[model samples]
Target: MIRVAVVDDEPVVRTGLRVILGSAQDITVVADCAGVGAVEAVRDGRVDVLLLDIRMPVVDGPAVLRQVAALPRPPAVAMLTTFDAREHVDEALRLGAAGFLMKNTAPEQLIDAVRALAAGRRVLAPEAVGQVIDGYLLSGRDEDAVRRVRALTDRERQVLALVGAGLSNRAIAGRLHLAHGTVKDHVSAVLAKLGGLNRVQAAVVADRANMVGTGPGRR
Candidate 1:
């Protein structure tokens, strides 16, 4: 089972998440806490993933993420935010958050997101993907970032396009009819190529180039 910790200031939010995740067969809520309780809970346990809120008293999500990063076996974190603020999302990423998700996400989507993060995959709300891209562009499209993207191979580019198109690794593997391990290799290559801080950045680049879809929209 994927061990999880739910950290948010609101008791209702924590309770709601527990209810949603409790229904999933593959997940277990190892702990649930608000504010300082969250930090203490995580420090004392072996959490595989953390569902974290961006705003909390005593200690906020971002601060919690920072502290988690310092842990010997840091769990992957999915930041839960009320808004799509670029600054908060960017800071979370810089602090090593695996992804940023909206708290109002659909029940099924939230469950799927936890599973994704638990399985070592990045999961961001659809709307937040655009913010990461737009923010990068508005920040002057950093030259190094462009160079990193340019380094991808043709096959790696194909894989990345599918990823940016919002296809999962398994889906991409099916599309390519390649082994899942091959797909994983290609994804790692793509990330290296884009110097992408994570899969989200690579997707942002794919979305920016209009290589996939009508473009990023609400998730």
Candidate 2:
């Protein structure tokens, strides 16, 4: 089973996530608590994925993330965020948070994201990502971003495009009719070729290159 820990200031949000994640047979909410309780939650069990509230009131999420960073083995962390927390989320990303999940994410999508995170894939919310890099890509269009995208193979480009569209590795695997492992390999290659820290950066390059819908979005 994929062990998960939830750290959010709101009790209701934690309970709701527990219920949603509970429905999935392979996932278990091993620890659920507020930001102050984060360290214990992660230490109490082997957490494969951690869902943290990005803007918690008292014990802020970024502060807690630093605590996790000090751990010998930190779990894959995905921030629970709303659209307005883009800057905070970006900072969290730099600190090694693995992905993002909108607070209003659908139940099935939440489950899928958690699974993807556990499998070592980023679970980014594309809509929020588009907002984060708003005008920045325009300046890099002809420079770094364009040159990086040019180096990808056709298959890797297809994978990068799907990734740009926020599809997970499994989804990309299905879309491209390749095995899941193959898709993971392609995603890793794309990150390396693009000189990206994570899939989200590679995604930014894909968007600037106007490649988001070019591959799998085609009929």
Candidate 3:
């Protein structure tokens, strides 16, 4: 089972999410709280994922995420946002959010997203994915980044392709039939070769190079 925590300033939103997620047999809403302090409730352990709202009354989702990131075992974050806010979506991704979901997402999609996250995969709403990719591709000065990305080993290239496709480290390990530690080493090497600060940056380079053909939706 996947343990989930919901953090939203609005009581209605929190209750709605709890209701929607409670219907999924594989997921349990372990805790639901308002404001940033709720993040601490799941910090020690037990929570597997966090459904976070971008704008809260006192402490926002990003602020909570900053705290979560500092924890020893941070739960994967899926920012709950409306589709119109493209800037927030991009910032959330850069801030280490695992994925983004529209607030109006269907119940089934929400369930699927939680499952995908549990399986170490990213889940972006289809429209949001297209928007993100469009912006990412159009962002300037790709030639240098592509050149650096080309320096990776065959295996590292494969790993990087998976990263660009939005597969997490564990998912990459499964696809490559490699131990998690080996995959980590390869990812580190790829990051070093490409001079990427994080997996997201490496993914941007990979996407620009068209190295990862299929995206996060594929297995």
Judging by lDDT against the true structure, name the best candidate: 2
lDDT of 3 by residue, 99-180 (tens): 7777778899889889987776566664345545544455445567689876777888888888877677787888878899
Please provide TM-scores, in order, for all candidate models, with all chains considered together.
0.86, 0.84, 0.67
Off-target runs (Cα >4 Å) in candidate 2 are 131-146, 177-182
Model 3: CA > 4 A from native: 130-147, 152-193, 196-203, 206-219
lDDT of each residue in 75-148, candidate 1, tens digit only = 88998877545555556766878876787889899888888988889887885676666555655654576566
Candidate 2 has an lDDT of: 0.81
lDDT agreement with native, every candidate:
0.78, 0.81, 0.76
RMSD of each: 3.4, 3.1, 4.6
Per-residue lDDT over 116-201 for candidate 2, one digit per residue giving the tens place of the 0 to 100 score: 89998787775567544552343343367568788789999999899888887777888889999999888888888876658876
TM-score of 1: 0.86
Any idea what lDDT model 3 has?
A: 0.76
Best by TM-score: 1
Better TM-score candidate (1, 3)? 1
A best-first ranking of the candidates according to their TM-score comes to 1, 2, 3
